[model samples]
Target: MGSNLYDKVHIRHLKKLGDLVPDVHKAHQGFAEAVMKDGVLSVKEKELIAVAVAHSTECPFCIDSHTKGAKKAGASLEELAEAVYVTASIEAGGAFAHSANMHNALDEAADDALYRRSSMEHMKKLRQHAPEPFDAMMRFFQTATAEGKLSVKLKELIAVAVAHTTECPYCIDIHSKAARKAGASDAELAEAILVTAYLRSGGAWAHMALMIQAYGEE
Candidate 1:
């Protein structure tokens, strides 16, 4: 193995995993194929979602693999870039949206509940507290999500996928509604969520290589 932690060669260890556990490996492969094959969303669309979710998961192997898959599926550079920006916006937006919790924590009268859907209304207080940064984040989010190279529907779908990977309920709720409004079908939304689910698992699966390396060293 290379001295670097995540060399491309490390992925080869996946074969060893398959050799060790053929049934589970084969099942995983089947599930991946079922989720990724064309249905409500095209293979290209699924790849784009995979790319965004891979970034959200911060999986080096997934980022590398799904990017290539996206390209092979005829995703343009512009489309892929837009998908990445969607991931960036959702990640940043999750933090921005969660500032409501901070406001609640600072309030002496606030209830003990850590996460109230109603507390999301407190997000408005951020603009009053820091107008400039708040406006900037909003502007960046608007730019990232607005239709350009990718359609609004596609961008919203990507946002939904990344939100699932980020495990942000606020993002998932917001983007899922946005996705529906943008004309995404329930089936399409379901596929996007599945893509996120697959990639998140694949991240851990990929990191098994690191575990194998550690065990070998010991």
Candidate 2:
């Protein structure tokens, strides 16, 4: 194999891991299968969630795998595009939401707390500071979360999954509640969380091939 860091062939090394760590590798495979199995959410929905999380986690292998999985499960290109936009909006929204901390630091706010719920109140200040871009971002976010090819419930579920990968508490709190309001059950929410967990770990699992290759170099 060539020295390319992210060649498709590199992923073939994942199979060798079974010989080196049979028990843990087997358990990881089992967990991945169990998480992606149909349950409260359909296979198509789970795959869509995986697609969104693969983007959030920036895992090329997971992105390629889940994007194909999503298509095979019957997701249309438009639906997959919407899932990617959902990931984009959430990733951007995390930074936008954190601007409150910037505002706090500027004011030398005495709370000394990093992420108070009340900090969100300062979001308006961003609007006041840069009305054009701030408003544009808000419009994009609204359109991203709004009903389209994907239902709001599914979009919100995707948002919750992406939020976990982003580790954005504000997005998690907001979207979890929005998901419930859109008629997602606790079971569904838990499944979405599990999908996020699997994909996050799956990223590392997929990258194991890179580490193995590096170790083999003379």
**Best by the lDDT measure:** 2
Any residue pairs clashing in model 1, and if so which? none
**Each model's Cα RMSD:** 1.3, 1.0
Per-residue alpha-carbon lDDT of candidate 2 for residues 128-182, written as tens digits (9 for 90 to 100): 8799999899999999989999999999999999999999988898899999999
User: For candidate 2, which ten residues in a row score worst on lDDT?
Assistant: 108-117
Residue-pair clashes per candidate, as listed? 0, 0
Residues 41-128, candidate 1, lDDT per residue (tens digit)?
9999999999999988899999999999999999999999999999999999999889888999899999998778898898888899
Pairs that collide, model 2: none
Compared with the true structure, all predictions reach lDDT values of 0.91, 0.93
TM-score of each: 0.96, 0.97
